[model samples]
Target: MEDLDTLVLRTALRWQATGLPVVLVTVARTWGSSPRPPGSLMAINGRGETVGSVSGGCIEDDLIHRIREGGVQAACATDTPAVLRYGISADEAHRFGLPCGGTVELVLEPVSSRSRLDELLQACLQRRSIERRLDLRTGQVELRDGRRDGVPRLDDTHLATCLGPQARLIVIGAGDLSRFLCQMALGLGFEVVVCDPREEHRASWELDGVVVSREMPDDLILRLRPDARTAVVALTHDPKLDDLALIDALQSDAFYVGAIGSRRNSAQRRERLHMHFDLPEAALQALHGPAGLYIGSKTPAEIALSIMAEVVAVKNGIRRPSPTPVVTGKSLHENPGYEVT
Candidate 1:
């Protein structure tokens, strides 16, 4: 339903009494490469207002144009669910600016109060995860049980998606890089938390929607218990603070624990954690020394972007092209001194 489609979709449905027409777009499939993944949702209002995205921009642009032509007016008759595809050839790919040889398919469904979309939205809001079994034959949806432990799962007939709530990012400093990283992470749907115990760092900090904490990094890491969906980045590089938090994080389930430093410094940090705290080689490897993809990122924002890419790749079961996988500290090779299976 529109509510399951985007947050804006729910707002549209809830505010329908205010009388505004809305259109919804969903990404159904892709081939070769695509900017947005399948299951992504976007919504547009009668006035060309938009929320979320399907393609990088081109598809959204095309959708916007269609809305202007009265594509999704509420007064229009309901449409049977339909599957739409884009970018079948090289020229089309270039026209849409899809990655070379890219193709994407989508499902567009119009919703009303009488539609089952409202039901689906309510079910989703009530549970950590829920499967809306769609009747392709009748378009009726049935709600089923789902899981919230670890990664959530959605095994539905029409689509399979696992949104484990929102990912959390805890940055242990309020420096320029942390600011950039916080913004980048927030855009990617991470609940960004910036922790700075120092007043100097907190005074000048001015990132929006980011949770600022004054607790010590180590204490905060333990409290947050960084889950598999969580990413922990230490930017201060101060062992007195960062090291303890890194130690605590290494023992938890955080998917990514990284420090911004040269590889050499990471090696030194490893030795210290290994000797002082007895952090095994396994845990140390998960400490992404030198963080970020090796994509030649130099600026604070770019570095933040690269690191986010790596974090996302790991989180989404996306295969990393690099030879060495970002170790999760639980891998066998990371444990030369001991064994954890």
Candidate 2:
């Protein structure tokens, strides 16, 4: 499944291509508390159809009402883009269902040939990060190199935002745990690939959205050369398969490299990598052994949930503290008196 941002852009482009008057709305700024952050995208068509979201239902309803009432011109006001603000007053905040004192500013651009949304979407499809600079005065856009995870910048005359590759997950195994992990990752809009050289495991691997590969784990890792938006998780519990994949993933730019195992096994795997592979301390430290936030998971599905949660946390720049580690939870479970030092 495509990520939300990509879905919005693709749908908007389709709407425009069909000669529907579409307005692309971007959340350019926010204050106090907001449902979505800056760079959030939404598209509304002349028929009151919408894809994506800027705020909760209230803001989207307002946008739809405006478009349905005054065609596309209501959102943009003219050929140039328009800036609209909501929740500027206490009453307005309540009406808009924004948190108290919350406010959001949006840029509404009427979709047109000059928008160059097709090129922007193409760049994203090709996994190339590009910044889209919107000339608010002229409604023309410029594309340049940018980070996939960049912040949106709004200035007096322009709105600059980055769009890049979808986050991807490489699972180094094919089993029940990997099955659940792949399913969760697909639902979360990640492009998932499952690799396992074991024919018995590969023979049974059939998931709808994930790509299944029979390549050895290390070879798959090397071939993919995971980028910053990518994540790698080893789940086979076999040292030969998991260890090599972990080594390559840790050395790469993958934002998350992890393995699922017991605390003891996790330590053993790390030792094996460090002792035999000569992996640097930093890379070893980067590995998320016993991957996942400790959520008392026992079933395969629950385990996948925990691991995917940690992967998403790390991807979103959230670092859980010491108390949340699987080791901490397992230790406490194993010994009632165990306390984190």
Candidate 3:
């Protein structure tokens, strides 16, 4: 799935190329409690069609209404962007579905040839992070290579927004668990790729919007050169497939490198990597063995959910608690309602 900002830009580019007027709305600032964060984007065409979002639903509705009524066109007539505020008052907040005392400031830019929507879209498609600067007075735009996540920067004259690479997830397996994990990752806006050299698994694998690779795991990992925005998860549980790929992933810039396995197996794998491969202890420490958070998951779906949750937490720079054993009194078949005493 494309990231929200990228989707918004692509939609705007399409509308503009079709000779339709488009307006790009960005959540420039927010206070108290806002559904969308700063730099969130929404694009609306002259025909009231919209893509992406800056708020829940109310803000988009209001924007659509304004577009239909020519309010937005009139505001952009001078070829200068306008800043609009919503939910300033209690009634307004409630009416707009904003939390109490919440406020959202938006920058509405009338899209045109000079908006460079196409250039921005190209950069994003090429997986290049960029910094986009918009002049508040002249509606001009400037694009540059960006190294960090984009944040909205508003001063007296210009607003600078960061547009970063879409997060990528490479699952080193094509199985039931991989299917669930890929789906969840897609819903989370990750460009997912599943790699399995085995023909039987590859033949049976069927999931939309995911790229399936028959390339060997280590070679695929090397070619991908996983960055900070990338995550690699090995669910095959086969050492020959999982270990080599994991070694390459750990040595790369990937923010998360995890493998699904039992605690004992995880330890044995680490020992082998150290003894035979001579992988450094620090790199081994970076590997997430027995991957997911401890949730006592017994099924593939639940395990996938736990792993994705952990990956998200790490991506958000949240420190997770150390893994713990799932405490249960007895097997589910023996004690369906088993509880730890």
TM-score for every candidate vs. truth?
0.69, 0.95, 0.92
Q: Please tell me which model should have the higher TM-score, number 1 or number 2.
A: 2
Model 1 CA deviation exceeding 4 Å by range: 1-17, 32-35, 46-49, 56-80, 85-103, 113-132, 137-157, 187-189, 262-264, 294-309, 312-341
Model 2: colliding residue pairs: none
Question: Each candidate: what lDDT?
Answer: 0.68, 0.87, 0.85
Query: lDDT per residue, candidate 3, 1-94, as tens digits?
Result: 8777778888898888898888898889999999999989998888889999888899888888878888457546666798889999999999
Q: Residue 127 in candidate 1 has what lDDT? A: 31
lDDT by residue (74-191, candidate 1, tens digit) is: 3233544445678999998998889999998866555444345565566554433555444433345455555323221223335433332356788988988888888888777677
How are the candidates ranked when ordered by TM-score, highest leading?
A: 2, 3, 1
Looking at candidate 1, what is the lDDT of residue 72? 70
Which ranges of candidate 2 are over 4 A from the true structure?
A: 324-341
Worst 10 residues of 2 by lDDT: 332-341
lDDT per residue, candidate 2, 1-341, as tens digits?
88998999999999888989988999999999999999999999999999999888899999899888888888877988999999999999999999999999999999898899899989988888999999999998999999988889999999999989999999998998899999999999999999999999899889998899999888999998999999999888788898889989999999999887766677778888989999989898898877877777767887888889999999999855254433534642222111112
**By lDDT, who's the top model here?**
2
Candidate 2, 302: how far from true, in Å?
A: 0.7
